[model samples]
Target: MYNKELIRNISIIAHIDHGKTTLVDRILEITSAIEQRKMHEQYLDTMDIERERGITIKATPVKVMYTADDGKTYEINIIDTPGHVDFSYEVSRSLAACEGAILLVDASQGVEAQTFANTYLALENDLEIIPVINKIDLPNANIQETISELEDLIGFTEEDCIKASGKTGEGVKEILKAIVDKIPAPSGDSGAPLKALIFDAEYDKYRGVIVHARIFEGTVRPGDKIMMFSSGETFEVTEVGIFTPELIPADSLSAGEVGYIIAGIKEVSSARIGDTITSADNPISEPLPGFREVKPMVYAGMFPGLPEYYGELRKALEKLKLNDPALVFEPENSPALGFGFRVGFLGLLHMDVVRERLEREFEIAVILTAPNVVYRVKMKNGEIVEITNPAKFPNDGEFEEVEEPYVELSIITPSEYMGNIIGFVTSEKRGEFKEVENAGKNRVVLKFIAPLSEIMFDFFDKLKAISRGFASMDYEIIGYRPSDLVKVTILVNKEVVDALSFIVHKDKEYAVAKKVVEKLKDLIPQHQFQIPIQAKSRGRIIARTDIKALRKDVLAKCYGGDITRKMKLLEKQREGKKRLREIGRVTIPQTAFLALLKIGEEDK
Candidate 1:
């Protein structure tokens, strides 16, 4: 066991691509936590997706022993957190487990949107912030400018900011020393009842659920009976361990320490993130304050390519939920796509990541429908219903009012792109201009209140193109507001395809409907009979198109026959074609569903 007074719990926080993972690599090397031969870039990022994307998706914790200049060994726990706004919940949970944070800023890029958001989160948690300017080795790096921005934004002086290069290990020692010297030690009674907060968890085929937790009081070891405070389920502890970047068996974990505990939990839902664990016999009267539940901002349907793989998809989703608690799904069926689940995600990026993981990690090829946001429908009877799927929306004259979700968007960009950005946001995106302010030298921050659906699909992509990839954005859901929203349904050969239905604003319904019908006309293969593709909205056909039939030469053999014989043959062929058109089915290919996702992209 190590001394609680000598232990410092800290987390590394920064915006996307600001070198948080690279900095952690340098820290691990200087502390001698891993052998030189075993060390690699992003050593703590165990997932292949994280490495391929070059971003941290999960908050990883590791313990390292460093001998300070005082000739004494100190135990330091470092939590590496994600910088994307979609994964802000991960950073918040990590902060709950640490006493301080290393706020890293890219010297060349200066302060972006997420930098300000994460710093405010740390301040709310009452954590000690160590400001560090990273990537100082780059030729375009402006260290003095970054320091001024940090002071103007967060009120940190030039002396408090440490200039470091994550690439060459410059000033790493100063960071380590600052962690040991400035951060406060964890204070708790080791003799009190056992209380550990479950910050994260993962599923294992052999060991079941392995829970990562931070101990607040008492000690936990193998053979002790523990209970989950939320579920009230009891189990005997089978193992206790710590991450030296990899799981290593430990004898025991006491208060003020972070480690993993295994209770042989076979059910994935039992060991939830933000759940509390304590001694079953001598449990604390009150549980520690847990994190607030996160609600998904976007919803999409995920159906397997083959129906037989439904069971496998279900099992895969259950195991993934053990690792990602933000993901939520429910069973639903579509006439066009068959059985599937409606999965909810934080944003478009979150949806893409989850879908990729499902395909790569679980080997499940899933067909995703177009994404949509939650809408509120107030019926004429004064009843309100929240709709995530277009098929569940009420028909016209049935609902008195419809409300859509709205967000408060913040964007930081160079001053030159401000005019174009504001024009695009207000004119094309239907956003209301809120205000604009100066962030630092040659940079400005723009704020807007926009409907979430307007920006859900391709808003970010357009912003990047207009700003030349220099702008960064962050948003929070403000509330729901009344909007003129209508549902657009697609019919292939006069049959409704539930998977092709979507919700759009009333003014843009004709444009969207026309695009969907025209795209389907090109994608749907030619059948034995002509097929009509129609888009319906508000009980009217706003757009229509047809796929030409593949015809056969029925009169080829009767070339020189008499006029009466040719007429008889022609009449007979016409009747057959008519009969076929009445019962023929149009097979909609999977590519058609994928093509619908790009409809909004074309408008841009």
Candidate 2:
């Protein structure tokens, strides 16, 4: 049996591209977890999308055995988490499974918005934080400045911070030593009943659900009966294993151990993250304190490009949900786009990533509608309804008031771009400036309260353009506030396209409607008859554009004809065209729906 005192559970948290994965690579090398011939960069990032994007989307756990200077071997469990605000929930789940965390900061960039957000998450979880200055080998690395920011912002002393280069493996040994010496060993009673927290799970076609868990008390072995606390479903554990960065079969997993369990759970929803697992025969009276339910901030419709692929899309989403519990979807029907799911996401990037994964991984061509935020509407009869789809929203006279979601926005950028960022956020994005703080090293942190709908489309892209890619932002939904929000419906040839409808603020309704109608006019293919693209708001047509009909020259056949003959031919052609316009049905191409999602760029 392994000793509990020799095991350490820790996680590495940082901002995007702050070198968390690189640091994990160095640690794996120093500890000799994988053979030199088999090792590669970002070894823990097993997904193709992760490698291509150069970002970690999922939190990955790995186990490495290291020999300390005192000649004693120790088992270390490290969870490498994603840095984007959209995936901060992944970081929180990783933290819940660990006793300590390595707070990583970019040496040149100093403290960033996500760095602060992640640090606070760790603090909330009561994890021991060891500050690390990463990418120290760069010529522009300002280690001292970063260390100072860590001290002033996070209250970590100079000695508590470790300077390291993930590329050269410099100070890597110190990181390992700190994990063993500073971070406390896991505390649990092995003699008690089994109690493990399901931090994550994956689906294998042959093996079923492979649950990643951290054991807090007692022991679990093959053939033991386990039960999920939330679902009350019991299963016979078939095998237990540890991630030597890969699944390696183990005899048994005891208290203070981090590993996986294959319990023949065929249904993906049975093994939920944050659900407690314990002995089926001798169950715990109360479940462990689970994580807070994650509420999606942005919502959009995802439909298959081919109507026949709806079933395949559903299966793919089920499997993806097994891995990402943050994604929520439900079946919804649209008159224009057939049938699809209304999916909810944490942010715009999260929505994009899910769509890309659906296409690239599952090979399902998807059509995504314009993203929107959920709105609370109070009717004249005093009934409040939450609307996620614009087609379901009440008409102007039916609702007394409408409230939209807002977020607490934090931005960290250089002082030079502060004015431009402030002007854009306040004027264009409808953001209310809160305060500014000096973050040392000529950088400033700006705070704002912005409507989630305004930032859902192109806020981040515009921020990056104005700041020249130096600005980083993070936001959290701060309750709803009353707003003059109206639903803008799009029509092609006087037929409503439910999928193209979106909700917008009343003040900017005309501008947004004009943009959408104009974009649709260019995207929708011309038919035999004229197609009028119109945007409707508050029972009135606010903006309209026309796609000219395809015409055949009647004059070409009238060559050498007299003027009266030409006029008669022209009159006949006009009558036929008018009849065709009344009966012709315009088919809106799929590209038009996709293009309408990006109408915000025109405003920029």
Candidate 3:
């Protein structure tokens, strides 16, 4: 067994673009985890998209050996987590596997919206937080003010905070010393029954699935049979290892140590995140608590641009799902778009990243339909149903009430922009103000309770635009509330396009429908016959637009002829136009459906 006193398991948490990965780079270099010649920027970020986008989409685990000022050695396992709100679940899982965390705050930007959310999550897990002020070398650095904000927000004094820059590696040694001096060693019973928490997992082609876990109570080794408490699936471990930048084989992983278990499992889905592992032969009576399955909050349909690539898209999704259990999909068919899958995501950013990965990594171009939020429908018969797509929404007579998810939203902005922010939130977005308080000299925090559906679509972008990029917001799913909801259906030439239908609040239906029809009018090409685009609610037409047909050149052939002959030619032309109208079809472009994304942007 290993000494729990010398092992420190910690995770790095921060807001987006707060330099978490950069700090990890400096740490690896100072600890000699990699040779100087092999060192590079963002070494732990393994994906090319991550490097290009400058965001960590996945949480990575690594181990390093550091010698402290006390002349003693310590084994530090650093779990780097994603900073975006879309990947908050990743942060939750990483926190479960660590005893302490380094709360990295941008020195100039101060604490952002996501920073507050993630800090609360870490505190909920009972992890000791080491407040670190990062990016101090930048010209706009406001170290003193940021430190004061931290003192107020988390009771961190100047002495408790570390000031450093990820760019020049300033204060790297001191930060390392602080980690050893301030953060407590991990605590666990090595002799107790096996209970390891699987924080992350990956699929390996040659060796099957590899699970990254932290041993909580007992020792785990090769040849030991382990059971996943959540799935109740058991398997024999083929190997045990730890990451030193790369995987290094280990004889065993005892309590308070972070490492990996390689089992001969065929799929990664069998080994899920946040699940507890225990020795099957010497099992624990109960598994560790706080484990819940990840649920998706956003839904959209993805259709292959080319109908022939349907099979390829299916295979790619299966492969991607093996690595991401949170991504759920099922076969969906649309009359306008063809066969595809209705995919679910944790949020909009998650949906974008998955789409990028599919197109860039798998080389498949796909069309995405309008996004929908889950709704709870109460039927007159006293039955409740959950619907994610408007195509499945029941008739008005069938449902007595519709309830949509709501969120507790918090916004941080400068005092000067408070008026604009409040006006937009209350008047256009239907937000209910809770309270407001001053965060610092010129910064204010606004709290509101708004429909999750309203904020889920382009709310952040608009907030930033209106505030001139000085505002940041965060939200948590509160619960479902009754709404004045109606289903808006779009019909093309009298045929309903399921992909173009959606549910909206009844008050905003007219404006939303008007914008959609106007955009569709410009996107659909002209046809031989008039094509009418209509939006309907409860079998009543609410908005309409028609694409006029192109004129025929029937008069070009009649140069000089009798009046009767010219009239006959004109009649024949009219007959031809009627025939064309009978058979003409309107092909809606894929870009037309993209207009639905900006339907609410024109509200103000």
State TM-scores per candidate.
0.92, 0.92, 0.95
Error of 1 at 53 (Å): 1.4
For model 2, the superposed segments whose C-alpha errors exceed 4 Å read 332-339, 379-384, 525-529, 548-575, 600-604
How well does candidate 3 match the true structure in TM-score terms? Answer: 0.95
Ranking by lDDT: 1, 2, 3
lDDT of 2 at 482: 97
| Per-residue lDDT value at 562 in model 3 | 86
- For candidate 2, write residues 1-604 as lDDT tens digits: 5999999999998888889998999999999999999999999888887888778987789999999999999999998888888877767778899999999998988899999888898999899999999999999998888877787678888899998999999999999999999999999998899999988888888999999999999999999999999989999999999998889999999999999999999876788778899999999998878555677878888899989999999999988887776789999997768899999998877888899989989999998887778899999999999998888999889989999998999998988999999999999988999999877667888999999887766778889999998898988778999998888888888988877777777788899899889888888887877888898998999999998878888888766957999889878877887898888878776677678866833352
Instruction: Give the alpha carbon lDDT tens digit for every residue of 1-604 in model 1.
Output: 5789999999988998899999999999999999999999988888898888888888889999999999989999998888888887777888888899999999999999988888998999899999999999999999998998887778999999989998999999999999999999997888899988888888788998899999989999999999999889999999999989789989999999999999999876788777789999998888878555678888988999899999999999887887777889999997667899999998888898999999999899998887889999999999999998888999999999999999899999989999999999999888999999887777888999999988877788899999999999988789999999888888888888876778888888898889888988888889888899998999999999999878887788985958889899878877887899888778887787679645722342
Each prediction's total of clashing residue pairs, residues at least 3 apart in sequence or on different chains, is: 0, 0, 0
Give candidate 2's TM-score: 0.92
RMSD of each: 2.9, 2.8, 2.3
Report the lDDT of model 3 for residue 438.
68
Report how far residue 219 has shifted in candidate 2, in Å.
Answer: 2.6
Candidate 2: lDDT of 46? Answer: 84
